[model samples]
Target: MKTPPPSELVAEWPLPPLASLGSTVRAIGIQRELRRHLPWKMRGFLRVDGNQAVLHLPIEEKEAFSAASAKIATAIEEISAYPVLPSEVEDILGISSRERHKWMKQSRLKSAGTRTVKMRGRAKAVTFHVFDAQHIEDILDRDLPTIWRQEDAAMSAENRKRAAAKRRQTRTQARSQSGCAGSADDASGSKLEGWDVFAAEGLLRAPRK
Candidate 1:
């Protein structure tokens, strides 16, 4: 039940592909018959049960069913070009989730003010959200691997900076607690043997459990 805003007005109505029908002579013939009785003007739901085609009328009709159905047929014809629900954008644009989000945040995946739809399979409706189809096509045309790699590098760098800062804070606190200025006995320097080149960068050893 996707009711356009009142201000938007149901200036047009369209029909969806007969989802419940199989692609067969009997099925397609039945669909063709059902289309005849469809209330296509303002808004209506078309349901076909066996040979019966039921056109569920709108709550309130401002026009004749025949007039509405004519408008609906036109609208339904135009719907053939629209992309209602696109599966994994990765498939359409050849990008990953992180890359997609990165581009979206940068307004590269879709132009500014662009929208992508949110579709409901169970409800059989497409929400107002819709992405720029041209943007997606450009993304597919451009090589986004480099951009994705750059994003990964920046993320890694940020993580490294945070880790280093945490380490520096830990070291500073440990030194303060030890109450030692140039305490040659900096316990963290390394576990040393009496006569050893303690001068060298401490051994890269695994930490004890």
Candidate 2:
């Protein structure tokens, strides 16, 4: 068998520190975005090792490597400041979509801006709110999710109590009205029965001789 030549194309770059940010999902997002700039054949060439992103290609594909490298470098520079997508924010904060929307709408989780992107293989565009990365970091650092959950629980308990009290009040009022009606009926019946007996004994007439 003929000896194979050694490969001459290899490029390695460190992923942006903010890319991982203690969240595996965020790191995956970063990788996906970087891959978008690569050709289909080069897509599988990318790999993440610890903090570094490595790319390997055949020597004959040097041009593809250069383009991919440049794009990766640019992404590293800009990705740190990029507004966090909703899914990314949810993963970073360990919150659900409903919670994220609630917090954002209430101004607890501030929105950096809106992002409009066309869905892949679809003609229609979709828009969504994006959040500042630093703001999310601050929120995570402060452990806001736990605090907000506690607050929500307390509010829910208070609401339940109020509802129960209102229901009790309604029942009490209904019973009171029913009891009054029953008492009126009893009094009316007693009065009619007494008058009937008096008439039968001829009490309304003069004493018989």
Candidate 3:
């Protein structure tokens, strides 16, 4: 016997501009949030399509799909409140990992909070900072990363110059001290040689001379 085709239910939610900040990572994050409203088995049925979250389910489960879709719709309305992940920020801002770490350390990249996720197969978990979506969007619109990169470069150059000057000053001081010590040693040796010569010439007293 041949199997019959099952009817399917389809729905899609257009993601807001802030939902992803134009970053694919951000879009996927929103997609995952929508999936959370569905059963674990049905979660995989929801996926990100460009700037939208699309859901596909068999018509036989229309009730479950409708309930889940309502929750997901509500979630979409509040998607702007979602915290932007570290990777999403990197993508949205077009920054490298080093730049992200440096800026974050200096408080240039403000963190919303920290997130901890367990590895798929490892026993240990990884923790990282997450950023506010609005904050990130503001930064992107202002092209702040370019400005930040310039500032960081300038600061690094200044630090290098200061370090070099300090090293030079230390070397100069070392040389000055070494020269003084050598002069003192030379003076002491001269006195000892004179005494030895005088004693050899007259074991008694050369004080009269």
Candidate 4:
């Protein structure tokens, strides 16, 4: 059998604004997405430039490489325009799930829609809210997450203050009621003592004092 020349092929695509979106975490996510479409052995060999994902393979495997390249292109297009998933939103915004839920419910983070996807090995499908990419970008540019967190902390402090004030007022009212009851009991006892004294002095007809 004749030996064939060792042939290699390479392809790359820029990640554009995505590269600037979520920092290192986002890049790792993009790399994972790319690797998901590749073979396990090929996954570990994948390379990512600053904002570009590159794939290298043997020319003999051109067909597979082409297919993977096409998928990558499609992924890039979709990621560029697609609404942000909840996880992606958290990464890009640097917010926690609790904070995301709070902001979403408060209308601080608007929802573009919902996404339903079945687990790879499960029959059940999960649905979650998706956010507008542009809107998220705007929030990021404005550093809104930090602002919101600060606002939340301030509000929490205010709530604690109000709760403490309410408890103090309740205690004060309880003490006032207790004092009034004590005074009433003292008055009643004094009246009884006075009556006893009068009866003893008059009714008993005291002899020589």
Candidate 5:
């Protein structure tokens, strides 16, 4: 029924600059990745401090901390290997959800691959596109998202213009067809007008038997 002792073992690792890309969420992702490499029970002991993750454990848990520290160091070394997540892509690229979706769909923002992870409170796992760190960096460096957005806007505008032209052409054709039909009907009516005269002349009547 006593409080646990203070943590005496400590270690820290700076987050990878490319992985974090000055995004807090991205940094948190790196921290989460570090935690994943450690034992589940000890995961909470690791936390983000400024731009790095620090691990703290009690003196009695020194051996466990040592092992966790090694894992964290290894994980940090390979932090760039972690896939750039969808949210991270948005933040790092300063793009909207729609932009991200559009570019990804068009392969402008090419996905290195996909990653599946279970949501914290959900029974189902969600799968999404992940980008390579270098790929993201390249896109950011070239400001490709802005270019993609401009291209998308132009495409949408062109599509709308084409659609409008198609609609106009369809209407014109419909009107032309209607005019022809009306002319035909008028001509037929005019021809029928002679039928009365022919009937009066008995031409349209059967010969008297």
Candidate 6:
């Protein structure tokens, strides 16, 4: 039996009207603020510039987007349909290269592949990775800074504990060696002791002549 091919979605472009684009941009902003509790189809989502927003919509819906509500749907449709790029993710996340690399190493952000581009005057090309928008969005929703800070605090505490333990061990060794000395004059007498014993763990204070 010949298996049929999967059907493609054939919806026409829904270019939103000037007013609708504004609504849609506003809607996207609102949903982001409200943590997406409200549906994106609510009113006034687009930015103040309807011209740019309108371009995001299908050609058909451009004229009919009069009511604020209708435009909200168009805006939602645009975001759902648009191909988000890596640059867009960087802008939306407000992260620098160091932070981005940190996330990539930690597995918070995933890349499709490594990209290489040559500069006009460069001897060699530069290679970099591209990330998916959905993965970036997941980071935003999870509030990565919160997790990063918590992990840092825990690590700092552990380091401090280890440092204190090392200090205590050094102090104990010094006290044991000093109590074993029969006299302060023994410092000059122990020719063999100088060859053994741990390296001075702390600074040695000399006597004033």
Best candidate per lDDT, number? 3
Model 6, range 1-209, lDDT digits (tens) per residue?
99875342112234333212233433344344322322355322333233333213233443433343354444555454333334545555665667667767877667767668798999999887865445555666687756875896898899999999999999999998887775665766866555443346423446556
lDDT on C-alpha atoms for all candidate structures: 0.50, 0.84, 0.88, 0.81, 0.86, 0.52
For candidate 2, what is the total of clashing residue pairs?
A: 0
The order of the candidates by TM-score, greatest first, is 3, 5, 2, 4, 6, 1
lDDT of 4 at 130: 84
Which stretches of candidate 6 lie above 4 Å from their native place?
A: 1-90, 178-209
Indicate which candidate wins on TM-score: 3
lDDT minimum window of 10 residues, candidate 6:
9-18
Question: On a 0 to 1 TM-score scale, where does candidate 5 land against the true structure?
Answer: 0.78
Q: Root-mean-square deviation of each candidate, in angstroms?
A: 17.8, 4.6, 5.2, 5.5, 6.6, 17.6
lDDT (Cα, 0-100) at 105 in candidate 3: 88
TM-score for each predicted model, relative to the true structure: 0.37, 0.77, 0.79, 0.73, 0.78, 0.44
lDDT by residue (tens digit), candidate 4, 31-130: 7777887778777656666788888888888888788778777777665665677788888888899999999999999999898989898889999998
* Count of steric clashes across candidates, in order: 9, 0, 0, 0, 0, 16
Worst 10 residues of 5 by lDDT: 189-198
Q: Which stretches of candidate 3 lie over 4 Å from their true place?
A: 1-7, 59-61, 192-209
Clashing residue pairs, candidate 2?
none
**Candidate 2 segments exceeding 4 Å error:** 1-6, 120-124, 193-209
Give the per-residue lDDT of model 1 (tens digit) for 1-209.
99774432233332344321222333343344445544444223554444333444444653564565564465445433333123335555455666666766766665334334356565554433244444444555576656767887999999999999999999999989777654656764666574256545455555567
Q: What TM-score would candidate 6 get against the native?
A: 0.44
Better of 2 and 4 by lDDT: 2
Off by over 4 Å in 5: 1-9, 58-64, 120-123, 192-209
Q: For model 3, how does the per-residue alpha-carbon lDDT over 105-140 read when each residue is reduced to its tens digit?
A: 889899999989898988999998988888998899
Q: After superposition, how far is residue 199 of candidate 4 from its true place, in Å?
A: 9.5
